[model samples]
Target chain A: MRFRTRRGIEVVAVADLSLDVADREFISIVGPSGCGKSTLLRVVAGLVRPTTGDVRLDGRRVEGPGADRGMVFQSYTLFPWLTVQGNVEFGLRIKGMAATERTRLAQDYIEMIGLRDFANHYPKELSGGMMQRVAIARALANDPEVLLMDEPFGALDAQTRIIMQELLVNLWQRTPKTIVFVTHDIDEALFLSDRVYIMTARPGQIKQVLNVALPRPRSLEVTTSPVFVDLKRTVLSSIREESLKAISLTGTE
Target chain B: MAESNTLRPIYRLGDDLRPHEPIPRSHYLIIAAASTLSLLALWAGLSYTGIVQPTYFLPTPGQVLATASRMLLDGTLAVNAWASIFVIVTGWAVATVMAVPLGILMGSFKFFEALFEPVVNFVRYLPVSAMIPLLILYIGLGVEEKVAVIFIGTFFQLILLVADVAAHVPKDLLDSAYTLGASRRRVVTRVLIPATLPGVMDNLRITIGWAWTYLIVAELVAADKGLGIMILESQRGLRTDRIFVGLVTIGLLGFCSDYIFKMVHRVALPWSPRIR
Candidate 1:
C-alpha cells in the first residue's frame, strides 16, 4: 500500500505482499533506518491508515485503536506519574474493569515479569531493562491477540539488550502471542524471529523473507551454532546489497 | 613496632572527632535568643545616641513593635490582614479556575492555540496596574473592583505558563496512551494533566507572589480596611511606626505564603525535581 504524508512525501511501504502471519508467529521485519518497518507495524496496529491497502485481523478490517493489539515502544513509554502497578492497570481501567480485578490482573502480569517487588516504584527509579519489562507487562496485561513491539530493546546497552532479548524469548515461548517486531539489528532479528523479512531501504519493499529453521525454546547459545551463523551471513549479505543499491540511487555513498 | 609510634599521633587526632548529628531543638532556641539580643542591642545603641530619627523618618524599633502590639490588641490588625488574605484568595482562586482549563485547551488544540495565543500575548504584555482606572470606572470602588484588579493581573500570567507547559508534553507519551486505547479525554486527564502538573505548580508559586503585589494595588483603590489601606492612612497622618508595621506585615505575609506554597508543592509532587 502507498501512503502519502502531510508533507507530500510518499511512503510506498508494503507492496504486493501475501504472507499470512499465523495465530502466534513471532515475525521480525528488519531493514536499515527509515525503511518504514515501524510504520508497517503501526499500520497493523491501526494507528496510521494506508492509502490503498487493507489490514484485517480474522477477516475484519481494523479501524482506529482497539484493545486487541498491544504495542511496546523502544522508549520505555511508561507514564512517569504512575507506579508500575498503576501503568499496568491503565488499559484495564479504560475497559471499565473493576478495581479489584484490575489490581489482580496487573499483579499477575507484574509478577510474570518478575517485578512484584517493584510494583509500587515509579518508572524513573527503574533501569532501562526493568522499565521495558514494565512496558511489556503493561501491553500483555490487556490480553491482546497481537503484540506489536517497535525496537523495544534498541536503547539498552549490549548486556542489558541481550538479557531483555532472552526474557522476551522466554515470555513468547510461554504465552505465544503473535508478535511483529521491528528492528534494525540483524542479529536481534535472526535470534528471536520465526521468520525474518528484510526490506529495501527508503520506499521500503519486502526484499526477502527467510525462515529461521532454528529449534524452538532458543537460547543465547544458539547464536554460535553453524546454522544460525549461516542464516546471519545470508541476512547480512541481503541487507548490505539493499543498502548498496540505495546508495547508488541516491549518489551519497 | 617503630612505625606504630608515628601512627599514634594521627590516630589520636582522629579519635577526638565526633560523628555529625542533627542540631537539637535547644540549639534553635539559643540561636533565636542570640538574634533577638543582637537586634535589641543595635536598636538600643541607635536610639540612645540619636543616630537616627525616632518618630518622623525612621521610627525606633521599639515604637514599631509597640504600635503592632496595640493594633493586635484592638483587633484591627487581624481584621485588616484577614481582609487582604480574603481578597487575595478569592481573586487567586477565580483566576486559577479560569486559567487552568483554558490553558489546557489552548495548549492541546492547535486551532485554539493559534486563535487565542496572540491575543493573550498582546494583553499579557500590558501592565496590569495600567488597568486600575478602567477597572474602577467599570466596577466602582468596591470589593468587586479589587477582585477584578487581582484577577486580571494573575490570570494572564498563569495562562501563558500553563499553556506552555501543556504544549511541551512529549508526543511519545501521548501516542503511547492513545495506542493503549485511551480516548482523547482520557489522554488529557490521565497523561496531559499529570504531565503538566509540575509546571502548573511552578506557575502557581509565581502567581501567588504576583497576587500579593496585586492585592496591595487592589487595596490602594479607595479601600479603608486592609494592610495597604493602613499603610496609606499612616503615611497620610505621618504615623511612621504604623507604616513600618504595615510594611513589615506585608513582607512577612508574602514570605510565609511563598514558603507555604513551596512546602505544599514539594509534598504534592514528591517525584518532581528537588528544588535547591
Candidate 2:
C-alpha cells in the first residue's frame, strides 16, 4: 500500500517516447527546461537504465556504457591530468591498443581538430572553447558508430559556440556517423540536425519532428537565411507551449 | 597629514583588494616582509628591554639564538631533531600505506564507506593526546609508543580526507570514461586514481604537517630523546632559552619539509589546476 502511494505521487520525466535514427543520420531533441530531453539522451547512451524499455545498437541491446557509442557532455569532461593527445588516445588505450598505433591515430584527430600544437598542453591550461574541442576530438578518435552529444556547447560563449558548430558540421560532413544531439536552443538544433524532435512537457513525448533541409558544407550564415528562420519560428512556438505547461505543472508540485 | 593623491596603484588598497583581484607579487613580498619585521621588532623590545619582567620565561631573541648555535655546535640539537623526524617519517609512511587503500575503497563503494566512515568519524574526535596514557600502558614508552601516537593522530584524519578527495571525482568524468569503453577496473585505475591523485597529494601534504605536531605530543612523556622531550626538560630547569631553541628547530624542520612537498607537487603534477 505504501509502495503504491509513493508510485502514485512520483513525477514521470519521460514516457511513451520512442525514437529512431537512420545510419549516419544527425537528429536533435529539443524541448522546454523540464521536458526530460537530456534524460532521453542518457537513455540512449545507456548511462541510465530505462524503466521498461531497451536501447538497441546495431541489433545488440545496450545494457550499459560501451565503446560503440561515444558521449560528449555539456561540461568539458576531458581528463584534466591527461594531455590533448593522451585524452584522444584514452579509449584506444583502454582496449589495450599498442602505444605506437594509438599515438599516431590520436595525433591524426588532434591535427584534424586544429590542436596539434597543443597536443601536450593540459586541459587546465586551455580555454573553455579549446577544452570542448579536445572533448570532441577525444570522443571522435574512438571512431564510434554513433556520437551522443548533450548540449556539448552549452557552456561556451556565443561566438565560440558558433565556431564550434561550424567545426562539428565540417567534421560531420567529412566523416558521416549517426549523431543524436540534445539542446533546448532551437537555432542550435535547426543548424546541426537533419531531423529535430520537439518534445512536450513532463512525461515527455515527441510533439513534432522538423526536417532541416539546409545545404551541407554549412556556414554560420545559414542561421540568418529565411528557411532557417521559418524552422526556428515553428520550433519556438512548439517549445513555448511546452514551457507554459512545465511552468504550470511546477506551480502545483 | 593627508595621503598623497598620486600614490602608486599598489598603495591604492581601496581598489587593489577588490575580491579576486591580486596585487603585484613583488609588492606582496615587500608588504609581507614589512609585516614580519615589525612583529620581530615588537618582540625584541618586549623581551630585550625586560618590559614583561620575566627573562627566564620570555627570553630575548638574541639569547634564544645564542642557545640555538650552542646546541647546534654540541650536536644535541641534531640528535633530538633526528629522533623526532624519524618517528614522524615512519609513522606517516605506515599510516599512508594503510589509509590510502582503505580510503580509495571507502570512496569507491558504499559498502566500504559504511564499514569505515562511522568508526573513523567517532575515533577522529577522540583526541590522540588523551589516548597517550592508554597507548603508553599498552605499547610501553619506546619508539613504538611514539610512532603509534603519530599514526593514530594522522591515520583517521588522513583516511577521511583521502576518501573525500576520491569521492568528489566528478560523476561526468567517470561517465565519460565509461562511454569511452573503460571497464569497472579501468574506471578505478585510469579515471578515479589519476583524477584523485592531485587531491591525494594535497591531503598528504596537509596530513604530514599535522603529523609533525603529533610528534611533539607523542614525545611529551617518558621520552629520553626528541625535541619535544628537550622542551619538557627545559621547562623543569626553567631554561626557556633552550626551550625556545627546540621550538625554533622544530619550526625550521616543518617549514623545510612543507617547502620540499610543495616543490615535489609542482614537478610531479604540473597539470594540477591548483598549481597553475
Candidate 3:
C-alpha cells in the first residue's frame, strides 16, 4: 500500500506483504514503528485499498468494508452519543434487526463483557479498560467471522494492557472468531496469538512467521514458563533489530 | 494560598480563579447577581443624575420604565413584538429546512461541495444591508419582503455553518459503521447524523442570533410594524424613553429565544457535556 504525504510526495507504506489466516485462529502481526503493520490491517479490513496488491477473505476479494470483517482501532472509537448497549447494538440496528431482538443480543454481549451494570453509561464515563471491553463487545455483537484489531491495547497502561490481553483470550475461546491482532508488544503477540507474523521495517513485508507452541487455557503464570520465555526471547530480539534498522534507515533519508 | 500562615482555609481570595476550581452554587449566584445589579446602578446613576445629559437622549430608568408600562398597557408593544418574532422565526425555519439537507450533501460528497461551496462563499460575504434597496424594488413593503430580507441574510450563512458541522464527523466512526456492514446511506443516517446533531444544534443556536440582527435591519426599512419600526419612529419624535423601550423589548425577546434554544438542546441531547 502507498500513501501521499501532505506535501504530495508518494511513498510506499507496505510492499508485497501477503498473509493468510485459518478460520477460528488467532494470529498477530508485530513490527517496528512505521513498518505498516497497522496499514496492512487496514488493507485487510478494506478501510484502505492497497496500491499494488489485493486482500482476499475466504476466496472473496475484499473491496470495501463489510460486516464479515470487524475492526477495533487503537483509539477509543466509541460513539460518544451512544450508551454501551447502543454501541453494541449499532451493527445489528444497521442490519435492520427488530428492537427486541437487537436489545436482547446487545444485552448478552454487555453481560459477557461484564459491563451489565454500566450498559447505559456513555463512553466518556468509562475508564480506559472498560471502554475497550465495550469496544470488543461492540465488534463481537455483530458476530463477524473475522475480527481485525490494530494495536487494540496500545493506549492502555501496562497493568490494563495485560488484563485486556487475558480478557480477550477468554472472549475468543468462547466465541471462536478468526482474529488478526496487531501490536508492537512482542509478549502480547506471543501470549495471545497462535502464530506471530513478524514484519520488516517500512516498506513493510513479512520477515518471519513463528508458530507459538504454548498450550491452550494458558494463564498469565504460563508467561514465566521456559517455553514461553524462549519464544518471547526470539520475538523480542527480532523486533529490536527491526526497530534499530527502522531508525537508522530514516536517519539516512 | 498564603503558606506563611501554615493553615489553608476552605475558601480564599481568587480561589475560584485557579483553573477549574469548583465554586459553590450560592456563591456563583451572588456573583452573577452583583454584576447585573452594578450595571443597572451605573446606568441609573448616569441618567438620573443627568451626567450623560439631555434627558431625552439618555432617559432616566424610571422614565424608560414608565414608557415601557404605557406601551405594554396599550398593547402596541405586544403587536410589534409579535410581528418581529413571527418574521424572524418563519424566515429562519425556512432557511433551516432548505439548508440542512443541502449542507449535509455538501459536506459528505465532494461533488456537492464543489458545486455549492464557491457560490455560497462568494454570496455570504456580500453585505445583506447593502441589498436592501434592491429587495425593496423587487418585493415592495410587504411581510414577504421582510421575510425575504431575513432569508437572504440567514440562508447562505446557515448552510455554510451546518456544512462545517457535518464535515467534521470523525473518520473512525464512519469506518466502524462500514465495517459493521452498514451501507453508505446507513452510515450517513446512523453515524453522521447522531455524531453531528449536537454541533448542528449549536450552529442553529448561533445563527439564530445573527438572524435576529437581520430581522432588525429588515424591519427598520421594509416594515410598517415591529420593534425596529417603533425604535425608528421614536427617534424621529425624540422620545428617547420609547426608543429605550424598543431596545429592551428586542433584547428580552432575543434572550428568551436563545434560552429556549439552549433548554431544548439540553433536553434533546442529554449525552452532551455542553450543558449536563
Chain A TM-scores of all predicted models: 0.95, 0.95, 0.97
Ranking by lDDT: 2, 3, 1
Candidate 2 chain A TM is 0.95
Candidate 1: list runs displaced more than 4 Å.
Answer: A1-20, A240-253, B1-74, B233-244, B266-276
lDDT of 3 by residue, B169-240 (tens): 878889988989999888888788888788888888887788888866888675778988888888899998
Model 1's TM-score against the true structure: 0.82
- Candidate 2 is graded, for docking, as high
Candidate with the greatest DockQ versus the true structure: 2
Model 1: per-residue lDDT, tens digit, B1-276? Answer: 897687565333233334674455766587789998998788667765678764377777888899999999999999999888888888988999999988988888898799889988899888877999998888899888888878888998899889998998887788778777888789888999998888888888789788988766888788979888888888889998898898888889989988998898878877664442
* lDDT by residue (tens digit), candidate 2, A1-253: 0011254876567888788889999999999887888887788888888877788888888899898999999987999889989999999999899999999999988998899999999999899999988898889988889999999999999999888998998888888989999997788899999999999988889999999999887788999999999999999999999899988978854
Interface RMSD (one decimal) of model 3: 1.1
Could you give candidate 3's per-residue lDDT for residues A1-253 as a string of tens digits? 7898899988888988788899999999999889998888888888898777898888989898999999998888898899999999999988889999999999999998889999999888899889899989999999998999998898999999999999999999999999999998888998999999999998888999999989998889888999889998888899889989998988954
Identify the leading candidate in terms of TM-score.
2
Ranking 1 against 2 by DockQ, winner: 2
TM-score of chain B of each: 0.79, 0.94, 0.92
TM-score of 2: 0.95
How does model 1 fare in lDDT? Answer: 0.85
Q: Go through the candidates in order and give each one's DockQ.
A: 0.49, 0.88, 0.78
